[model samples]
Target: MDVQLRQLRAFVAVVDEGTFTDAAILLGVSQAAVSRSVAALETTLGTRLLDRSNQRVTLTGAGGRIVTRARRVLDEVDRLERIAQEARPELRVGYAYAALGKHTRHLMKAWAVAHPAVPLMFVQSNTPTAGLSEGIADIAVIRRTLADERFDMASVGCEARYAAVDTEHPLARRRSVRLEQLTRYTVAIDKRSGTTTPELWPATMRPQTRTVDGVDEWLTVIAGGQAIGVTAEATANQNPRPGVAYRLVTDAPRIDVRLAWWRDDPPPCLDTLLAMIRELYSAAPPGLPRQRVPMVVPPRARGRH
Candidate 1:
């Protein structure tokens, strides 16, 4: 009944990476350490979690049933640790790629003027929840809608899509590019936190893909001229890398920016924070300049599409 967090992490990593060697590499540990941790986890749970017969590792029925619960436990532990490490009272806003794009600093200054007592801070986490679920941030700025009912969300604004290309690439010379136009090239994507996916294109027109883990890697691949990337406009504003250029994706749909927090345990000054965000968004509707954001609209009331 005694289980360690490291054991759970090792089991989860192996399940995620499909090989012990890869899991070790991810965790910055040796392969023997990963194997020992998994073994210890299985012993503690009194269940065989993995099938290691083939070149790739797979989950047993028990593992399939337990992985989700394990993830929840880890997330809760992480949240607890974050709460314990707090140095002061401040609003921690999380984002995966770009935090509010060009609106980030304006929002911070506005919050400072309104809530002078509590500082507003932005943190980056390359996860789907942008560090919200991981307990790294008090709230999250997410491009994609959260389906989890435990959290409540409101749309703050929408941003146009852009194509990231190498400076030497032909697409870099164009003012804008169409979705179909990039189909002939390989697309670099972050499946975990990135908004763009192969699903965005028609099945027949979908381009070859190279998977990257984060914004830095995505930019590197694109800068190498081996691949291109599609992302929200905020990336262009916040992450202008050398040898990489961003052009508008004229045919792509705009990405909605939303603020999400725990529904049952809303943060302090929640209403004030939400109002400030909406005010900012309304003032500038993506392409406009210095427009106030609108009133709060709940996630349930709006469809992602």
Candidate 2:
């Protein structure tokens, strides 16, 4: 009932070293202490573990069986400790959809060079906060503003909105389409994780909507010509489907790409990541306009309506 790790270690040490004195020296403890620890272990198990009647210390039959299992337990405990110590070094960034779009690879390469000691990992989770709320990620790249009070986020960049339509659809022939034109089709949206919502349209002009769980489903539905999808321009660049065509939504507001983390105890590299991303967006090529929105928002005012 009351077993301790030290007791197990002491028993195994005495068995391997062939004597209590040698085991005590290996453990940096007194011989009497090692003897007491082994005795306590045997008492707890209600069995005699060591045959002290012999000149050379030997194990009882029960002790031999238990020792093998005890050694395995000790080894697992050591492994767990090592994992816990190494766990904090890696940074995991979660995303619901296109993670920073075309900038993802460039940002990863830059971080590798800038912080070689700390590794970067990307996780995809189709929840609204990516994996932040689920505790699977230290930071998340989300398309919309997160209104949760527990998180702090920054607008790292913005991208033009685009409509995804079937390749054979009439609108696919046009170079771009306005928000009003999209209202004519049934729009597919991922209500849980998607940035596009019915609220984006005026009350009376709102398009009929269909719900999909993730990006792939949305693309599939759009490709089937039963619905159309409105998403960040990055989605077009990141996920190009053969049956789907992406067209610019010239009248819709640009989608904001945000980086978010828990506010109370943010990762140590948060500020560095923010700066690196800000620089990446600022250095975008001539044609792409870089819009720098102020990063911080008041805690209580954070979630999507």
Candidate 3:
């Protein structure tokens, strides 16, 4: 059976308004149009929906059962319309965790100066796509690879990796830490959206991992000293918790920060956004490699030396 959304809307509207005249007024359609819509709906459903008696409209057994479902359907249709409306002018950039970190404000200010009418907003969604796939955002800041062919991605920048350790942890005293040094401790990782993974280290050297769903949980676990966390510099810059010290992961590869959008339906101002990001990254990028402190040997190795 062909079920039209308008027909469902008309049916629900009639039920809500008590009279066909009121329903027509609410829908901004003529009473005749409202009557015809309701008639067509009943005809399509192959059942009498309403009892029109004494200029009053009341529900039949079938109508009573169907009215609730029709309201639900109309509600869903309204939601779908809202979703379509969201794709208009404003740009919503979603991120699974900490957005551009220290650069977030800079980018916002730059975008505002460039495109004052179209607002640039950041939304946090702890999903792999950030929120692109879920329709919660028009663009996404994805740290890891999003293998979906449905979306196109641009490599905007890269962030250095940082080790999150409790202040009391011995490694926290160091200016920087290495992957090998962290191997002895359990690492907290958000497998879905986090940039770090066990694969960063060789199979033999990989640390025991504790899985977390989001950044808050990861930080809590690290602050509690249950596990150490290795994350993008963005996390360190934005999320500094008490008792949690962030140290640069000197030898680990940097996390590639990328912007992703639907391949078929990229957002407006995308080029401007990309250009601003490139300029920001190019102007004041991550620290130079030469600045990295040499890895300090652990106490065990230092004792032998």
lDDT of residue 145 for candidate 2 = 61
| C-alpha RMSD (angstroms) for model 2 | 12.0
Candidate 1 lowest-lDDT run of ten: 287-296
Give the true-structure RMSD of model 1: 20.8
**Could you tell me every candidate's TM-score relative to the true structure?**
0.65, 0.74, 0.68
Regions of candidate 1 where Cα sits further than 4 Å from its true position: 1-87, 285-305
Error of 1 at 229 (Å): 0.3
Best by TM-score: 2
In model 3, where is the ten-residue run with the lowest total lDDT? 287-296
Q: For residue 151, what is the lDDT in candidate 3?
A: 96
Q: Roughly what TM-score does model 1 have, to 2 decimal places? A: 0.65
Rank by TM-score (best first): 2, 3, 1
Q: After superposition, how far is residue 43 of candidate 2 from its true place, in Å?
A: 19
Q: Model 3, 131-168: lDDT tens per residue?
A: 99999999999899899999999998888998988877
